[model samples]
Target chain A: MNIHAISAIYRFEMNRMWRTMGQSIVSPVISTSLYFIVFGAAIGQQMGAIDGVSYGAFLVPGLVMLSLLTQSVSNAAFGIYFPKFTGTIYEILSAPVSAFEIVLGYVGAAATKSLILGIIIMLTATLFVDLKIAHPFWMLFFLVLTAMTFSLLGFIIGIWADGFDQLQIVPLLIITPLTFLGGSFYSIKMLPEFWQTVTLANPVLYLVSGFRWSFYEISDVSPQISIAMILVFLGICTGIVYWIFKTGYRIKS
Target chain B: MTDNADILIDIKNITKKYDNGFTALDDVNLQIKKGEIIALLGPNGAGKTTLISTVCGIITPTSGTISVGGLDTIKDYRDTRKMIGLVPQELTTDAFETVFDTVSFTRGLFGKPRNPAVIEKILKDLSLWDKKDNKLRELSGGMKRRVLIAKALSHEPDILFLDEPTAGVDVELRKDMWNVMRKLSQTGVTIILTTHYIEEAEEMADRIGVISKGRILLVEQTSELMRKLGHKEMLIEISEPLSALPASLSDFDLTLSDDRKLITYSYNASHEHPGITRLLKALIDADIRTTDISTKQSSLEDIFVNLVRDAA
Candidate 1:
């Protein structure tokens, strides 16, 4: 198991978050706060309610999902990439730790950071809107599952990226656009049938829809389908990670 | 000086072929004894690092087997890795970590329990105790190299591999590193280091192994290698200038100086009878008066250059 190695890598990574606390933790909180102020206060007054819930309240889960997806990926990607960039990965590779332990250490710490940020964003959202949770347990479950899934995606990205620009490509280009179009600011039902079908194809929609269902019992997709989609995504990411370790892909060679 | 039973690492016919059809190692074989210092000498791209990396399990060989202390590197990877500590060629450390924290963390990475006293002693041995709390980014290049050594030793492994430990370090620090290595050797830690510096191998290693073009050229005891391959030169300074060598000296492979005043004779020191007495008698019989006589023994540098040049 090499628990000490896991904890060592975990503690080392977690300590880096404290060193860059402003960028890692605070920037997302402040950015999400601004989203709340602009979307919940300025725009919600004119937009009215969504599915019998206030527009401000409806935006909470979506906004949190937006930040959660991007932050988790970026945090995990940069976590692994920086080690490769600096050549410190050799130390880890030569250690007594196995590949699974290394992944658990890096992915676990990154998810923990993103989860903390997700909770903070949720708390900050309460300041701008009156939020409700119809399924608190499911809400927590979805929060953790999404963080872990996206963190694993970020880990894969970290290993695949050969340069700094590539590290930002997925989070900025793909994830941000998907989250924006994933029912973050509005319901997918408002779109035409064609666009609704297109929006449903975006993976982020499943996450936001499932999380919104937990909060208000109003969702673009069924809760069970969303959970199933996320679980599949989680499984795929885990399989890729396993393959990476088995082949000694970027970390070893 | 150890016996066969003391062999700590056994690498047999290990070969590494990269994905791009390049063979980095070809049928390499070596046996390292415990508690002895061995230096692997080769030019850049000679696969010195690759061989060490394979034994450390960082890079898997395409074929063959490697066992450390009788534990197969692949089947018992954790146990094998636990027995080794490597100070890689690259200068990499966590920029934000205090020296103490990083060293302590590396020990834990090897699954070692907390032992502050041992860490303190290693820091003190490397003269890094004063900077224990300083961030690694704040240290100089030499101090960072020492920190790498401290990290490698933190786990208290049975074998340590140092890849070019003194490449960029200054003379004083190199000497300090040598002292630390000497101290470690006294404690029965087997040391294998790869280096381009010939003098480092000469000064520190008990055995020297030369590799060129992915093949092991030779591995021999330091003193024995010197005696076997080393050539000695006898320079005879004539009291009077001679335009040509005397007929009696025609049997020797001798050369005259450009100024025509010195006769130099080269002979293998390992020869049963070096024929020094015969050369002196020949000089006397020829009535070549000499003002000075001196001999020079070849150094490890000369032997290394010759070996590499021949291989090329």
Candidate 2:
């Protein structure tokens, strides 16, 4: 309800990102661009088109999701984590702002940053491969939902992590590997039948599949199931965050 | 105003027990009047910070309740929180933020509407106006502390808690902070400060509370505490060196200096006459000539140290 507090935290966090533009915005854009150059050009030639769509264009949705997922989690996690590390969180804790407002500010800003990067990467994809979104509205929906969900996950990681190593552990060891294995560069159908079944178990697969479905109308899984899975994940993250605030976990005591 | 309402902060039997079974606070009770400057003095880990944190809603107490303006801190958190501003002990600020932005942001965090004149006055009062546009990372430590003060005051709360506000500060800044506090007190803002320096309390606090080992040992008016518990000592320099005290002077609590030329007497300052005349008469009767005599009153530091030492 305290919109001013939320906006203050949001602006402060956004300002930090602006000050570190090279690390926050530029690095991710350039890295995703490299994925385009290496995966789209070099690897796309080796593999033929799948589902009548060129390999390079097919890689666009996956690459954007890959960056979106990783950046969302890391950005939100680091957003809250840095304040905890520097002890500035006390100022927030002692203020009149509620815990929900605090989360909204940090998570909202992180999601916005990740969403912007996702869009820029999408635009940059046009330079390498001719891509089209069959459903632009669905594409935007998936982008915002995925950004918010992962940003919530990042907020959890930020609170749960006690050190810098722990903060980076989830994004690096878990999110990145899962995103890569979830069909960022290749489709699940390309794997053996048994591996394909196992690959479906990865939650990142649903996210990427649903996002890819928006671009080419083709996915490893049904789009409806992917949306349902993301909503469920979002609910779980919201519940955990509520419990954290109620118990004052890592923040109060 | 009603009685309870006049009591700005009513802390009743508040206790905080950490999960590990360590009791950080034990049945601490205090009532702070509006517009009175109180100093909570204690050693590190004496629960000074815990008590303040509990009252401020940063840490919840395991038992009992705290009410600000008759509103429970937990049940009515937002309302009570809006009434308080806390300047924490740690010097924490966003390194990339400019002073004006950070201070303005803190005001917004309190859900207060923007008032440029108020912000400008606070900045000017804290002597931070010149550095308003500079990033926090570029400011000196003292300036950062001032910014903390400005942020706390930005909301214009009725009560302010300053936790070791002058720790590690220079002498000039310390004096300057004291002056600022005095000026604020004149505006009827109730200030409660926790400090390691007894001199700070002596200089500013209208009332003093001593907390040690999770218990509030004493809370008394500054003048009343000094009058009731303070001891005065008289040092008498004798014309002739004596190896032993005279039998007539044995009734007085006295100590001979190491050189044997000085006799020192300790007594309560508020007592009627303090028996100094009788002691001097005894000295004369005993043929112990006293060339010179001077008296010194014990400071709040002495009272604090003795109280803490005895409590331990």
Candidate 3:
């Protein structure tokens, strides 16, 4: 609960993040731009506009979500996992640092990285296609909420992981695949009824739908439902994360 | 020691058992008087690390209790942790952090206000000031070990636990670490360490406790333990080769050494045994002759091994 400890850790972690500005900040920008080139410019010509938005414009929210989720996961994952890998966890664990301080420092840095990248991708999306913002406030809202949620998710993943291999398993294999299937690039309504129903099961669908609704003023799912789903998801993830910290699960023993 | 009422730690019958039912520690009881260094020594998997972890409140015990400074380790972790600094057996510091920032961050973790002078003194004592701006990965392993020490001491805890502080350390750095421990102890900081190397324990501990097979076999003053139970060895240089132990020399507990050119006898120094004269005469009667004899006194290792084996 001490703000000083948490701020100290947060500051140290921020310095560490800026040290890898190329990987943390620039790489996501480049990746989003490439999506515009290959998927937006090239593929949009054939696919035309799906639902009510251009193919290029349609992919923006998904790309933003993709970056936010992965960056949040990776930033938090590498942030925590490296100490354990390089044997520096002993320093952090043995100090007077509370579990809350450790979590705040790491998760706060991750949330910061996600927010910055989300904005960068948003600005980058505008250059490739005529991007619009129907609700800039909601867009910022979902962006910050989703970023914090996934940052907490990444915190859980980091503690659960013991080695580098463990750190990559959930993000690379699970999160990436879910994003692809969650209607990031294509609308579920375009699919057969059965596939559309299955796509509803993807938790990522709400994140992308909520974000897209903010920009286009229209989405396949209701904006209210999308917002609610994200909040619920955040609840589940926050519960898990704080519970892990309070009990001193993997971090302590 | 401050009146026993002010005992800094009270560890009562703590036991640790893993998932597979193997016990790492069992029925261990210890009280650490304020301002004392207690060394826990044992062979590998002898529960030394387990004991320290339990007291530090990092790992929960399967049974019993540990109270540090006055707070229970599990129930009152926040207050309890404030008074303890544990340098783990692992070198787990941030690889990309500068030495100054790492130690300073450690102080901040204890809710201490930013103090550059305190951080400077800690780094200076650890010889880390010169490398204050170097990333940890850029430093030598010895320097990294010093960082771990500095980070531990940065919080200025009343109690510090060093687990194998010199396990892979260089001799020079080992001596320096010893000096640091002495300085901290002089300031009335309680130090407890678990070490695989007995010599380090012999050099530093006021009292030594040997842990083996999930139990503390003996806890005694380092010197007193040796005086009471340590054994000695004497090597006899024989003029003639001996193929086997003599029939009448069974009382000597002897072994052939140097390809049978010498006979070595081990005996408890505290107990009455067959005199060296009787041993030499028995060797002569068996047509065994020795040119000279050399002797070696017992060390802490000998006493440690004997106690562990006896309990096992």
lDDT of each: 0.91, 0.90, 0.83
Which ranking of candidates, highest TM-score first? 1, 2, 3
TM-score of each: 0.91, 0.91, 0.85
Candidate 3, true inter-chain contacts retained: 0.64
In model 1, where do residues sit more than 4 Å from their true spots?
Answer: B1-3, B233-278, B282-298
Candidate 1, residue B59: CA error in Å? 1.2
Highest lDDT scorer: 1
Tell me the spans in candidate 2 whose CA falls farther than 4 Å from its real position: B1-5, B233-275, B282-298
Task: Kindly report the docking quality category of candidate 2.
Answer: medium
lDDT of 2 by residue, A58-139 (tens): 9999999998999999999999999899988877888888889999999999999999999899889999999899989989
lDDT of 2 by residue, B1-312 (tens): 237656899999999999999999999999999999999998888999999999988888999899999999988888898899888898998898889998998898888887878999999988899999999999988888889889999989999999998988989989988998998899999999998888888889999999988889899898888786568899999999998997878899999999999999999878877898899889889999889999998777777778888987
By lDDT, the better pick of 1 and 3 is 1
Model with the higher lDDT, candidate 1 or 2:
1
Give the B-chain TM-score of model 2: 0.83
What is the per-residue lDDT of model 1 for residues B26-107, given as tens digits with 9 covering 90 to 100? 9999999988999999889999999999998889899999999999999999999999999999889889899999999999
* Model 3 per-residue lDDT tens digits across residues A195-247: 88888888998888889999887676899999999999889988987798677
